[model samples]
Target: MKQKIAVLGPGSWGTALAQVLAENGHTVKLWGHNPAQIDEINTYHTNRHYLPNIKIPTSIKGIKELKEAVIDVDAILFVVPTKAIREVAKEVAISVNTKPYIIHASKGLEQGTHKRISEILSEEIPESKRQEIIVLSGPSHAEEVAVHDITTITAASEKLEAANYVQDLFMNDYFRIYTNTDVIGVETGAALKNIIAIGAGAIAGLGFGDNAKAAIMTRGLAEISRLGVAMGADPLTFIGLSGVGDLIVTGTSVHSRNWRAGNLLGKGKKLDEVLENMGMIVEGVATTKAAMELATSLNVDMPITKTIYNVLYEGKDIHQAAKEIMLRDGKVENEFS
Candidate 1:
């Protein structure tokens, strides 16, 4: 069955998702704030600013106005970065009347407020207008998804129906979607793992071999689980697709922006310089601060996150931070309790 889908962002991830939907035989509207990007998608069958090389399908239309994009869509996939989800959602809510199913692909906690993307949407969209509210997440990366690689992700929501609905829309040969009820855990796992990936990248960039990278990835997951559990997420979910699965993929994959940003940081580049050169939003930088603060407020033990927070925000040296973490560890192996 064909559905009208609106992708509420024109970044790489959003464009990739729109491509997937178009491949699934759905009519897709790819919305962007940039007029040139919208024009590229509409007139040239490409998105020059993001996902430059991939050719967009003719079925996927591009729209600059939020209202124009949301019109008559059966599902609206919010694929904006976490930092911008709230603001975009706010703008969307005011003009949207179609009451389409809300599916979010963003992964990060809001800064200062420490609110999850779902929470932000809850506050922004009217209570009566809230859709099933689905979150799509897992080990999938945008670059791979654009090329029609075999990618698996989980579609989760508090409501089982929402998960099933999203699963039906996104599932296909190269793209697999699993349904889960642990929305909180899935979202937290997806958001928090990026921060850990940054640390993993830093470890890799410091000339540390596989062993060090493995340790960083492992310990980073431990901290992510600890904080997530404290915030009412299921611990077992952390070991599943959205948790450890995502950590392994992002921490090691070269496609991860967070990992690349951390690699430059470990190479001794300043934060501003790294950000400027990358020309993309490194979500983990902001997410780390939000996660660290949230963990502190919840009294959760997140030493790895704390150390990364110091290295990124407080100007602590990466090597010094690693040494401190290495020396302070005195715990039994295979015991996560």
Candidate 2:
């Protein structure tokens, strides 16, 4: 069955997701704050700046007004940045009167609050107005997903029915979706991998070879799994798509903003300069701090995450941070999360 979907965010991920819905024969309204981007999506069917090579389907209309885009829609898919999730949900609260499935593909915990995107949506949007909050995430890169490259992601919800519904909404020949009941594992795995991607990028920027990338990704998975298990997630979920799969793609891909930012940071660029140069949200910068705090509160030991936090926040030398990490006492790999 066709549905009316509102996608909030016109950046790379949002635009690509809107294309998926349009290709699935759903009515899509892509909402954004930038007038020029909105105009390009509607008039030219191209979002050249964010997605340079792909053309948006004409069935996907671009709308400037949040209310205009979401009103009467069967589902609202938030592809915005982590920080913008709450603000957009607040608008959805007052704008839509009917029940619509509230879904989010944005991955990151709230910087200061350590809340997941679904939590922010739940806090802002009343349940009476929505079916359920669902999370869509995995190792997908918008550049590739937009081009119809083979990709698989997970849709998670507390309820199996909600997860299945989301899976059905998105699955296709090239784009596949799997349903999971472990929302915590899926969201944390999705969010924490960005930090590891930064580490992987930093290693590459420092002229390290594939050995360094593999080391960080492997150890990074351990630490990410540690934190996830501590936070009440099933440890097995960390080994699945949202966990190891996402880590591989985001940490290694040039298309990841977090990796790019980390690459610049490893190349001796300051945080502000790296962020400015990327022209997109490097979620790891903020996620590092939040994850550090969360780890502390949970008594979860994340050595790699801690080192990245010190380098990013305290301006510690990356080489020294790397040295410190290397000097740490070794541990039995199988015992922790």
Candidate 3:
């Protein structure tokens, strides 16, 4: 059934998802803060800064006003950064009259509170005006998804019906969506993998071969699973699409902003310089801090995350951190489980 959906945020991920929804026969109100970007999408059907080559569907209308996008939508898909989730949700709460399903594709933990995106949404948006929140995540990259490359993702919600609703909305021949009921596991895996991707990129930037990259990826999964399990998530979820799958793509692919930023840092660029050069949110940089704090607070052992955090924030030498990671006291391979 075709329905009207509001896609908040016109970044690469937002625009690509808007395209997918439009192709799936939904009327999309693609909302962005910048009037210039809205005009570009409305006039040229192209978000040149984000998805430069792909032409967006004319069916996707660009809306600058937040209320205009949410007033009559059946669902709202948030593709904004983690930091902006609360503000956006608050704005939507003021505008929305009828309850609409809230789905977030953004992956990252909040900086100070360390709350997941869905939690932030729940806190900001009144329960009376929103349906069960859903999270859409997996290995897919916006660049590839924009080009019609085959991609698979998970739609997770506390309510199976909600997850199935998102799955039905997004599933197609090129894009596949699987449904899962483990919201905590799904969200934790999604947020934590970006940190591992940074480590993977640093390994690559340091000129390490496939062996080193494999080691980082393996141990990265171990630490990710450790923290996730400690935080009340299913241990097995780490091995699924949102966990191992996302780590592989984000860690190995050039399309990942976190990996790209880590690569620059590994090559000796300063964090500020790397961020300025990338001109986009490198989520892993922030997630590294949040994850490290969470792990420390939970008394979970996450050496890899700790090292990456130090390297990114404390000006620790990357080589020394890598060396320390290699020389850490040995443990049973399945200790995390």
Candidate 4:
């Protein structure tokens, strides 16, 4: 059945998703904070600043007002940045009149509280106003998904039916969806992989070979799994799409904002400068601090995350950070290693 969906945010990922929904025969209201961008989307069917040279479906309505986009919607897809999720959800809570399906594709834990996206949503939106919170995550990149490249991802919720419902919403030949019940693992894996991607991008920026990137990614997954397991997520979920799959694409892809940020850092640009130049949110930067705090509190040892965190937050030299990872005490390559 066709549904009225509100896709929050007009960034690349959100625009891509709104286009997908519009193409799938749904009424899509893409809400954006930027008035100029909304005007561009509505008048020209293009978001040149975000998705350059890409034509958005004219069927998708660009909404500047949050209340207008969400009121009476059948579902709300939150694609805003991690930090912006709460503010956007707060607006939706007061505007929506129905118990819409709440779906978030954003990844990252709250900085100090370490609350996952779903947890934050649960706290803001009363149970009477929403269905099970669903997270859509995996290795898929917005750039690739925007171009209709073959891609696969996972939709997870505590309830199987909720996950299935989301899977149906996004599933298509080019964009496939797999359902999982491991929300913790999926969300943690989604957030943690961004940190590792920064490290991998730094390695690439430092002129490292494929072997070095391979090691960083492999060890990165180990640490990601460790932290996820400590958080009560299924160990196996770390190996699935949300974990290893996401790590592969985000760590290696040039389209990744996190990887691009790390690349800039490796090339000697400061955090503020790199972020300012990128013109997009590098989720790994904020997530590094959040994950570090969560890992420390949980007593989960994540060497890669620690090293990356040091380089990102402590102002440690990138070269020195690489050396620290290499010079660490010898250990096995198993899960615990």
Q: Give the residue spans of candidate 1 off by over 4 A.
A: 333-337
Give the clash total for candidate 2.
Answer: 0
Q: For candidate 1, lDDT tens digit of each residue in 75-174?
A: 8899988989888888878878777788999999999899999888878887566577889999988889998999998998999998999888888999
**Model 2 lDDT-worst window of ten:** 328-337
The lDDT of each candidate is 0.87, 0.91, 0.92, 0.92
Q: Every model's Cα RMSD, please?
A: 1.3, 0.9, 0.9, 0.9
Question: Against the true structure, candidate 3 has what lDDT?
Answer: 0.92
Q: What TM-score does structure 4 among the candidates reach?
A: 0.98
Once all C-alphas are superposed, what RMSD does model 4 give against the true structure?
Answer: 0.9
Summing lDDT over every window of 10 consecutive residues in candidate 1, give the lowest-scoring window: 328-337
lDDT of 4 by residue, 58-163 (tens): 9999999999999888899999999998888888899999999999999999988899999999999999999889999999888788899999999999999999
Write the residue-wise lDDT of candidate 2 on 1-337 in tens digits: 9899999999999999999998999999999999988988889999998998787899999999999999889999999899888888898999996799988999899988999888899999988989989999999999999999999999999998999888988988999999999999999999999999999999998899998899899999999998898888999998899999999999998999999888988899999888887888888888999999999999988999999999999989998888889899877777274
lDDT of 4: 0.92
lDDT of 3 at 14: 94
What is the clash count of model 1? 0
